[model samples]
Target: MTETTPFGIDLELDETVAEGHYSNLAIISHSTSEFIIDFAAVLPGVQKARVKSRIILTPEHAKRLLRSLQENIVRYESNVGKIVIPVPSSPGDTGPKMGQA
Candidate 1:
């Protein structure tokens, strides 16, 4: 059974959607009206990476999403441990060198 929100929108999760996609890197670009987020998986030796998903949101909604992510990250770190981002050896260097268009 699904629960309805105060706005009367029923929230339901399908099996496929619940399984979800895995994205290691995210590319974010924005225009005056909206923000575009592209989720991708960059493998160690892969020549090219494909965008798994693209989500567009208004600037206001993007800011709200940022806040929500920050809150969740904080809670996650508290339960687990601090997440670490390793500094790359050089500028423009990640796991693999690939040209993305």
Candidate 2:
């Protein structure tokens, strides 16, 4: 087991990606040893429920989390077989990975 340090969290969220002038927004929060994330979005012609994404954890909990995720990934891979890695293209590749004009 690894020892943990007391750390703080800060979020730098930019809502510029949201469409038009209606942008949903939020701030990140945390306690001394745990971090939290709250994400929200507003839909057109609908009441916006305060959808939240909360993650609370210590350092040790983080390792256990990786283990759990890896376990599920292993199971998924066993069912789906090998997966392909996306090949990164070089410049002048004429792919959609390039920005729109």
Candidate 2: regions farther than 4 A off: 1-32, 35-52, 91-101
Cα RMSD for predicted model 2: 14.7
TM-score of 2: 0.38
- Name the candidate that leads on lDDT: 1
State the displacement of the C-alpha of residue 44, model 1, in Å, after optimal TM-score superposition. 1.9
Model 1 ranges off by over 4 Å = 1-9, 89-93, 96-101
lDDT of 1: 0.82
- RMSD (Å) of each candidate, 1 decimal: 4.0, 14.7
Q: By summed lDDT, which 10 consecutive residues of candidate 1 come out lowest?
A: 92-101
lDDT of each: 0.82, 0.53
Report the C-alpha lDDT of model 1 over 1-101, residue by residue, as the tens digit: 46688889999978777788998778888899999888888887787989888999999999999998999999999999899877797876756322222
- Pairs clashing in candidate 1? none
lDDT of 2 by residue, 1-101 (tens): 23334454454445553233322543455567764544555455566545444456775675586698789888989999966656757655432221111
